[model samples]
Target: MSSSDIFIGEVIGTAVLILLGGGVCAAVTLKHSKARNAGWLAITFGWGFAVLTGAYLAGGVSGAHLNPAVTVGLAIEGGTEWGKVPLYLFSQLLGAMIGAVLVWITYYGQFQAHLTDREIVGGPGAQDTVKAVPNSEPGPVLGIFSTGPEIRNVAQNLATEIIATVVLVLAILTQGLNAEGNGLGVLGGLITALVVVGIGLSLGGPTGYAINPVRDLGPRIVHAVLPLPNKGGSDWSYAWIPVAGPLIGGAIAGGLYNIAFA
Candidate 1:
């Protein structure tokens, strides 16, 4: 694909990916939404479908490496050229932010209703009380925008993200081998979507399976900047785990593939 194709395809593809993926999270978490309390299975399946849709949309144009981890893994595996890496990463991040904004717009009313409800925030006047770090934690709706750990252990959280992302990028890398080195081909999107769901079901309990650095960071940035009333801090302190762990995992997967699978 040409540079413009890659750029356009990644921006659109990644926007769709975050739109549906984060959209599912918002559906399950936010108030006054039909899919509220839909549980983890719903989220995993929703993300899988999101991946399927985004990948299928951009596959023909940019090979649809929507996740930066996938892009990095492929580059290390010699599938994508190093020169194109920056474009892919930049486009993915930009697309992810756009998608997050779309999610906010799609569920604007729910967000407003949820944030204003005292019970949702904590209690009466909780909105004013729920301050950042020194006083309290991030706001209630932050989870809809970014991943956070159920348990706050740095090593454990980092390891879980790395392992899960390694599984994701490795699965993507090997799919080409199964297809006789023809790339993902027609089944690639579906296969990758299923793999994402599998990872979520199996390993998502820890850090919400960020697996892709841009996926988490882009939306988290959006969360920080959006003018949502009563929304708390963006949890910038723990943000590095999602960004660093997946990147490290992608590089590791690439090196491992070269050593064994390639």
Candidate 2:
């Protein structure tokens, strides 16, 4: 495939990933809904399947490094071209944004309806009750459409992202190392899916374990742009951790894998 084709594939693959990924979050979190707080198990499995599909669709043509961290890690490990790294990252981010935009559109009506109902139910004096709704707060913030530990401290959140990314990258490296083919085939993809499930089941409690920067930032950008009642976009503050942590973890995993095997 040409570089342009690779770029297009990455963009489309990443978009699909975030659409399913964040769509699940919206399904489970929004008010007056059926899937609220259903369980972390569901989210984990959903994400696993989502990634599997995304990989199947894009792996052949573009290697499906839907996450920038993954692309960087592969490049650093000499598995991919350094010159293509920027293009891959840009494509992933663009795809993520597109996916996020679709997610916002999919759930916008529901969000607005919930918000309006809440206002009517609460009347003018229920400030606290309104604040409890996801994305109702005014300004940039994480976990607006999701839930994490009660503590909102940055250090704790960053730690959660770091650990989650470490586990995810490690899993990716392991799969990359042992797979028989150049790209992950069906069996290999299934194993990678399981890895995501494990991460979500074990490490998803804090900050929702958004191990991919595209996964987190893409949806967060949508949250900012979409007009929902009493909504605020928490940008810049906690965003960096998701981007930084995953890249660091991916690099570490690549280095460790090389040291152990090479």
Task: Name the runs in model 2 displaced over 4 angstroms.
Answer: 119-150, 177-182
Top-lDDT candidate index: 1
Cα TM-score per model: 0.94, 0.85
Q: Write the per-residue lDDT of candidate 1 for residues 1-262, one digit (tens) a residue.
A: 6889988999999999999999999999998999999999999999999999999898888888888888888888988888889999999999999999999999999998888777876665655653422314677898999999999999999999999999999988988733212247678778999999999999999889999999999999999889887787888989999999999999999899999987
Candidate 2: worst-modelled 10 consecutive residues by lDDT: 138-147
The regions of model 1 sitting more than 4 angstroms off are 125-136, 177-183
Candidate 1 similarity to native, TM-score: 0.94
Cα RMSD (angstroms) for every candidate in the order listed: 2.4, 3.8
Q: How many clashes show up per model?
A: 0, 7
- TM-score for predicted model 2 compared with the true structure: 0.85
lDDT of 2 by residue, 136-200 (tens): 44332235332344467877877777777777776776675332213566677778788888888
lDDT of each: 0.89, 0.70
lDDT of model 1, residue 231: 88
> After best superposition, candidate 2 residue 147: deviation in angstroms?
8.0
